[model samples]
Target chain A: MAGDGTGGGSQVVLVTGGYDHTIKLWQAHSGVCLRTMQHPDSQVNGLEISPNGQMVAACGYQHIRMYDLASANPDPVITFEGITKNVSRVGFQKNGSWMYTGGEDCTARIWDPRAPPQTRCQKIFQVQAPVNAVMLHPDQSQIMVGDQSGIIHMWDLKTDQNDQLVPEAEASIQDIAIDPAGKMMAAVNNKGNCYVWALGGQAHPVPRKHIAAHHKYALRCKFSRDSTMLVTTSGDCSAKVWRTSDWTPMRELRHETQRWVWDAAFSIDSRFLFTGSSDSYARLWDVERGTLEREYCGHQKAITALAFKDQAV
Target chain B: MEVRPPEKQKSLLAEQLENCPNLPHRQYLEYAKFDGTAQMGLPTKSFKIFMTMLPEKHQNYPLVVCVIANAKIKDLIGFTCYKYSIEHPEISLGSVHDYGLCIAEDDGEVDWAFPCLDSNEPCSKFGFTCLGLIELKYKTVCAAPIPMPEDGIAFHMFPKAADSGQSHQNTSRHNTGGSQTSEAVISAIRAVNEDKKKSGDVNLEKIQSHIMATEAPQYKVYKVYLLRKVRTNTPVQLGVSLDRIEVEPLVTHKHAFWQSRSKYFLHSIDSVAWCQVLETRGNRTTFRIIYSPSHNAAYSDKNISGNTSFFHPNSTYKVHDFECEHDMAKEIVEKVNTILDLRNSPCRREYKTAKEKKSQTRRSFHTKHLS
Candidate 1:
């Protein structure tokens, strides 16, 4: 499980299950555990926080669950279960009104977070291969889906239109992040390659730059708030920062334990970068100086997800 | 030298005078073209005459040789005089008046001075000399050198009449000295011209390319994190590892430009007086001991007031003062130093833990005993 900096009185964390079949919450700057919400029957595979930081959505074996951080544990306020196979990843709209789930069912489903329990799940689009990861565009009207075949499919919700799928990669697509300005999209493939593409053009989504981002599999990628920097975590046991201007590497963080870094996220101010690794530790880094400031090591297994919440209202 | 006959002299003079239509009869004459018209005029008080003397090879003919006059007298009087002489079959007075027209030569000899064939006394009240005479041959006037006035009762002749034999010597001298000087001047002019041509041919593009090719590429080595490791007597296998390497470009002041500005300040304090240290989130403080060899003083001199400390050869000092995890710092420094030492060592080597080394030694002893 990974903790996110929240915009509230307390920080919230979404935990994917390993030894513990639950997602937990903690205070942001202080490492005090706040809540523990258990999964019903299966391990939690993925978790995503809404841009507003009010809702946390988790996908598991056969269901996608959305939890309002303000509510108590044991049950999600809303749940969706239309996918036939285990859901691998989940994402939320920036406004917290909608949720998206990608799974082995080879389709990405969109759900209404405000709908009644009976009517929450809805099928949006189908892909050829199992969708491994999904991310909602910052605009909240479109969703980008990465599949097992490494192709990325963009679904426009408003017009019910599917953009042409981008091909030309050789591995599974693991993670995707859209720049804050919505001008570029960065995608990391399972083979450790990262490609940045330009947005809004008659020209095909040509990769603006390509980097052999990691020595091994790159599991996750995220852009900073100002969109000037990118942070990535890899199976190579390291995290890296890249400058967006020239796609040049800024720094690499390596650990002596050689833990598999599963996910990385930046704070809203982008002063801190947090990486969750297989060593059951979540380390906070001073991004500018590339120094590890603190390490939270409470989890028993790998921490597969991480996020930062803004201050609470 | 034999004198040329008078008949021949008259013919030469006639030839020399044939085309000269504006020869002034009484004062120095000058001709200049202005607005496409030749203006033959005379200066005041001064007089000029053109004369041609016949050579011995053509004594049967006479020609004019030279022109002479006092230019300063002409300027004073504002007009010049011109005169010509011609042989006539008449005698006027005494033996002096029996000769053809004569004028005194300016050479100041009395015997060669002759009275005018028409008037008995000196030709003019001002004692002016006839400028020269003309000699002719086949319609062309040839100049001959005039004789010295000491030759008694001599007729006025051109000055070049006496200089013809020496012309070959003058031409050879002129060729040697004048040509050498002219050649040197010409070569200097050529060198300057060639330099200008080469300067124009310089390719600025190629020069820029060469500069870029030869110039060293700049590198920025940021102090990402200082790893500190401190090992007790425990013989721990210390190794340092860098996790994230981030590089940010830092623009440093050019050494020459900074040094030039440094000259304006009397002391180091005054040099940085106007500059303030900026406090940024990750700003780092650096400490160095600066010593001036010329001043024979260290940065810790009493006159300099700051936190700066001087470094001495045999002295140890605690340099850095910052708060960090003590264990992590000690481990990092030790590991970094171990790596540095390994890299600096001449022999390529690796370290084995004490346990591993002990086990290996025991195994080797056992094998030797078995053998």
Candidate 2:
């Protein structure tokens, strides 16, 4: 397994973090652990790789830590603290100018990495309840923040206008995702339902359809880079791949001891899925065949959050 | 295993079975009840509700004559015959649990020695003695066999040893209660058959109708419910009719039979108070008949041989209450209401005709609204 961009055939970095309070970088294809970084204080809630592929940011209780992907440092290169509660998700802008994070503190914060540590938080978009997910639009102006109160707050950074939509009553929005084409956006709730909306304008979310994707709590939903498929992992212990064209199920990837699959990431080609589950192993599954391709087995506890990037460098 | 043939039916039973297609069932239905004119005006003291305790209680009563009615009665006659000769250990759970009326006796005799209360003077005055049981081989009452009630009063009649004179002589001498009791019922039926052969009066209905007309019991107990008195927690039969309420101790023991029932006329009842057992958490419906036993002699019925009082009938007011399971309580109320309608009253008939017309219109309006 190669390190990062400079010395790689195909730069593929898979980082998983969980309640064990450690971040593990695995060889996505060979199932080897190339590095383990200590998260130090709390369990990691979410993880995302920067668009430049040089850094990976992990959000946890009261902190968001960015680790240097090019170096062998076992500690976070920079730790941003003073967040009041557990941060749920972290993502970067398409140009990597800023970072966005949603947290149990009921706010989504925009942080500029170049700014001084004390003044890094550039903006705060507050909602009625703790935000569980935040997704950046392809245009990079509209930020969709899904919260515990079932409201999806679409905050347009360009005009500072906010719009809210509730997909279900009394169901907490667990995760939200937008296709790379920017045409479709889907949000999954704790009730195992996935709601799809046709995105025309920045805030106009037309209800498309409802799909019952799982029988239990759905944890994470992500769209393939090609915008052809969607993979949703759930507490039902299976990550399901559904074709976006007809919204039909393609396959269900399940392992004997998978337990609750907390997070999943799609391969760039959409042929495979990497799932982190409560069984302390991040599994690579062939999306079409629904077979176990490999198991990344070094985590001591649950591998709750994972970030994957496979790109030609 | 030896291959044996099915026992040959006596020629007379086969002939009767051939004559009457439903002879076995007819015999069962006809003979099972002893609540007819045959029981009327008789020494009711000599009668026991429990057929199994016949030998112990009504030893002097002519059990054979009354029991000649049907197959079930023939089985009861076996009970009386056993009274004449042998003691019974076989009279067990069936007779005791169902209170004699619904005896379910199996084929074999059972001899069990249980400790009896020898004396009440000492707490430990207990003695073990054998409960004697006699073996009975039931002969088919008819050639065309019939299915009887599943758990009703059914027992095998002792074999008559009709083919073997020697065995018949021994059965009568030792009187194992085997032959003598059944002989009377069989002979009477044979007499009926003999009369049928001569006169062509082959119908059993004629005989039954005659009995029903002439034999209304002292208390024509219409509907009987096996319930327990709420106040005393003792088992009782709440026999209800349109106007008569007979609360008798229904334990089926000699004492329960002798314990005079608390009788009341429904019209004399100030109020019939009953708890809604269907919704009660206790699963028991407490039914009470509160009666102010009127001093008026005009309403008294002269069926009882002498004056009988229940909960002091002479008292200004009395409440007779009993409790039963919810289903049984519902059944009792439903049956009582049905019997109340069975009473012939010209005034009530006219009122019911008018009420039906009103209800019919109400029902039609509701249906129209629902549609």
Lowest lDDT block of 10, candidate 2 chain A: A1-10
lDDT tens digits, residues B1-371, model 1? 12121121122111211212111110111110000000011111222222222233222221111111222322211111111111110100111111133342432122223432232232233444333332112112212333423322233321211211221121211121111112222332344335335445326754443333212111112232221244221111111121111112122345544432211111121011011122223334311111121222322243332223345332122222221234433323333332222121111011112233567569657856775
Q: Tens digits of per-residue lDDT for model 2 on B1-371?
A: 12122232232222322232211111112122221111112121112222332233322222211221222323443333333221221222121111212212121112222221221122112111111222221212323323322332443342332332221121111122222223333443454357445654445854653333223221233333333344336565666533345555455566555556443233311122222233434776655444444432324443241234234544243445556676666655554433322221222223333445567579657856775
What DockQ does each candidate score versus the true complex, computed on alpha carbons? 0.00, 0.00
Off by over 4 Å in 2: A1-10, A201-203, B1-371
| Cα-based lDDT for every prediction | 0.47, 0.58
Candidate 2 chain B weakest ten by summed lDDT: B21-30
Per-residue C-alpha lDDT of model 2 across residues A44-159, encoded as one tens digit per residue: 99999888888899999999999888775555666787798999999999889999999999999999987656788999999989999999888787899999999999999988
